[model samples]
Target: MKKPLVIAATLAVVLSLGLAACGGDDSSEETLSNSELIAQADQICTDYNEQLDTMNEEAALDENSSRQEIATYISDDLVPLYQEQVDELRSLNPNEEDAAAYNDIVDTLESELQVVEDDPEAAIDAEDP
Candidate 1:
């Protein structure tokens, strides 16, 4: 298996699936412009990346770490973090025209994340045929 730290990097890549950003106050129904949507999504992505960087440093896993250890880190630590990002993206209020496409992206992301969360071992198994 690869070093556990590499898992963090890979997770970052996977989690960065494009965000379809729409903006509104939590309690209000407001429509955001295209630029506003992009901006909100960009901010969320930025925050997610920063959080991942911190997590990677904190993990401090050496090359000798076991596959189980890596998998556990992914399941226990990384999965929840990425899940939060997905949830935040989902919360965005896309316009009616964009809503279907936005939902499709979110659904795809959730499915992909579920695959890793269900069997993190498969993630570390680079040698799998």
Candidate 2:
């Protein structure tokens, strides 16, 4: 269960960063350098990862916590956080050079988040080793 949760969290960071790396103003008149785009994206991922790490640590401190409780947290808390990140990523207009890759990552993250939102319990179950 923890494995799956960790994997999902890691993927969220990776995908968010990937999305960020390509983000910029959509205007043809304005474009960010690749380094600038990556830096911005990296910051978003850093913040997101920090929050996720804190949540995981807090959850770990509760040895008596039930699977249901974890599931509830993931669904009610974590999913919303991921959604916010995704929303932020979507708002960024990628540079022309990175648009295709950026859009692909954004789509993938949206799909992954939808699955977790729709059936958080199943997601938890799938993590069982």
How far off is residue 129 in model 2, in Å? 12
Summarize candidate 2's per-residue lDDT along 24-101 as a digit string, tens digits. Answer: 432345655666666665666667778877777765624355668767877877888788777766666667787678
TM-scores, in order shown?
0.84, 0.74
Could you tell me how far off, in angstroms, the CA of residue 21 lies in candidate 1 after the best superposition? Answer: 8.8
**Model 1 lDDT on a 0 to 1 scale:** 0.71
Instruction: Note the residue pairs that clash in candidate 1.
Output: none
- Over 12-84, each residue of candidate 1 has an lDDT whose tens digit, in order, gives 6665555634431121376555566567766877888888888878987677887777888889988898899
The ten-residue window of minimal lDDT in model 2 covers: 20-29
Cα RMSDs, all models: 3.2, 3.7
What is each predicted model's overall lDDT from 0 to 1?
0.71, 0.66
Candidate 1: give its CA RMSD in angstroms: 3.2
- Where is model 1 more than 4 Å wrong at Cα? 20-27, 126-129
